[model samples]
Target: MTHKIAILGASGYTGAELVRLIATHPSMEIVALAANSKAGMAYEDVFPHLRHLALPDLVKIEEIDFDNVDLVFCGLPHATSQSVIKALPKSVKVVDLSADFRLRDPEEYVKWYGGQHDALECQAEAVYGLTEFYRDDIKNARLVAGTGCNAATGQYALRPLIEAGVIDLDQIILDLKCAVSGAGRSLKENLLHAELSEGYHPYAIGGTHRHLGEFDQEFSAIAGRPVKVQFTPHLVPANRGILATVYVQGDAQAIYDTLQKTYADETFIQVLPFGKVPSTRHVRGSNFCHIGVSGDRIEGRAIVTAALDNLTKGSSGQALQNANLMLGEEENAGLMLAPCFP
Candidate 1:
C-alpha cells in the first residue's frame, strides 16, 4: 500500500525539497501541501524548479485532511512547530524539521530558545533524528525531531571520536562555514543580495548560538561528563552546503580510521583518505556527507572537515530518512541520488 503524505509549510526551501524527493518515490504520494502564506497558489507557482511534478495545490494547515495522510512532514519555522504538532491527530505520524523537538529538555529549550515550551508532553516523546546513531529508536518512534543542520554536520565529523575516546573531550573546537539557504526562504534584510553577496561574516559567537544546546547535550551524554566544544558558524554567499572544520587532540590516523570504520557500511557518509580533505561542492544538492582528516604540524592535533548540502542531509533529506523509519519504508528509499558536482 502506498503511504499518503502531507507537507506542511510547502512554500519554503525544505518544504519544496520534500516535494522534489517524494516526486520520485515509489511508495509515497503527496496527497496535500500546506503553506500559510501561499495558501491559494499551485506548487509550481511557488517553486519553478519543481514545476515538472503534478502536485496538489497549496492550502492552509487546517485544510489538510489528516485522517488520510499516513505521515506528515512539518517544515514550519521553529516555535511554530510545537503548537502545530500538538494539534495533529494521534494517528498521523510526523517528522518535524524545526528546533522545537530536537532538544529533550524543556529547561534547555527555554534557556536557548527563550520562553517556556508550551508543548512539554510532545517534547519528551520526540526522537532525535540522527539516523545512524538513533536508527533503532527512530524506527519505533511516533515523532522524530530532525536535528539542526549544523549539529548534524558537526556530529558526522566528531561522534566517532567521542564514542571511541580517541580525542581529548576538553579541547575540541568546531568552525563551520554554511551557505545562506540554511537560513530558509524567509524575508530578512541581511539576506538581501546587496548585503549578503560578495560578503561573509560570523554570527552567534561566544557560545550564544542555539545549536550549542544540541552539541552540549549530545556530546556530554556520550562522554558521561560535561563535554563542551567551542563552536562558531560563518555564513557564506552560496545557496547550499555546510563545511565543518573540527580541531581536536588525537592521532590523525586514528581519527581517520575511526571515522572510516564507523561509516564504512553507511551509504550517505564518506570518509576521505588520511591527509585529504573535502569541498562543499562535492556534496551539493545531494544527501551525502564527505569527511576528511588531516594532521596539524603540532603533534597532538588533527583537523577533521565534513561537508554536505544543508538542505538535504542537514534538514529535509534528514527528515525523510527518519520518516521512512517511522512508516516502515526502506531507510534509503528515494534518498540515494548522486551528489551534484561540477
Candidate 2:
C-alpha cells in the first residue's frame, strides 16, 4: 500500500532531500509540499535541481488537508514545528527534522532553544529518532524527533562504546567538521562563497554548541550518570557531509568489536575495516554512515571517526527511515541506494 506523505518546509535543504529520496520510494508518495514563505510558487523554482520531477506546488501549511496525509515530515525550523505540529491531525505520523522536540525535558528545551515548548503533550509522547537504537519505539510512535545532524554523527560513533562501558565517559571528546549546507539554505555572511570557500574554523567551542544538549541527554541516559563530552564543531567549505573524530580512552579493539556487533544488522550503518578511516566523500548524497576506529600510539587512547551526508543520513534520510517503521513498511524500503562515489 502506498502511503501519502507531505513535506513541511519544502523550500529548505532537508525538504528538497526528502523530495529527492521519496520520489523513488515504492511505498511512499508526496501529496503536498508546504513552504509558507514561498506559497503559491512552484517547488522547482525554489530548488532547481529537482525541476525534473513533477511535484505539488508550494502551499501555506494551513492550506493542506492533514487528514489525507499518512505521514508528515516536519522540516521546519526549530521552535516552528512545535506549534505547527500541534495543530496537525493526530492520525498522521510526524517525523520532525528540527531541534524542537529532541530534548525530553521542557527546561532543557527552553535552555537551549530559548523558549518554552508550545506543544507539551506532543513532546511528552515523541520518541527520539535515532533509527538504529530506537527502532521499536519508532514503530509505535505518532511523533518522532529527528536528531541534530552533528549530534547524530557524534552518537553514531559513541553510543555503542558508551552502552558497553568501553570508554571513559568523563574524558570523551568530539571534534567535528561540518559542510556548509548543514547551516540550512538560508543565507548568512559566514556561509557565503567569498568567506567560506578557502578556510575552516571552529565556532561553538568550550562546550557551547546547541547539540551538546543532545549529547548530554542521550549520553547521560545511556551511562546512567552525567556524561558530558567536550564537543567542538567546525564549518568546512564542502557542501554535504559531517566527519566527527571522537577521542576516547578505551581498548581500541574492544570498541571496534562493539560497534561491529551493534550495527551488524543495521542496513544503513557500515563499520569500515579496522584502521580504515571513513571519508565524507564516500558517503556523500546517501543514507549511509561509515564508521572507522583506530588505536593511538599511546597506551590507552583510541580514535573513532564517523562520516555521513549531513543532509541525508543525518536528517531527511533519517526522517524517512523512521517514517517507514511508523507506517509498517519495510524498514529499508526506498533507503537502499548505494553511496554516491566519484
Winner by lDDT: 2
Tens-digit lDDT track of model 1 for 252-274: 88988999999999989998888
Total clashes for model 2: 0
Q: RMSD in angstroms, all models?
A: 0.7, 0.8
Task: Predict model 1's lDDT versus the native.
Answer: 0.93
Evaluate model 1: give its TM-score: 0.99
Using all chains and alpha carbons, the TM-scores for the candidates as numbered come to 0.99, 0.99
Which residue pairs collide in model 1, if any? Answer: none
Q: Compared with the true structure, what per-residue lDDT tens digits does model 2 show for residues 166-231?
A: 999999989999999999998799888999999999998797889999999999999999999999
TM-score of model 2 vs. true structure? 0.99
Task: Mark the regions of model 2 whose C-alpha exceeds 4 Å error after superposition.
Answer: none
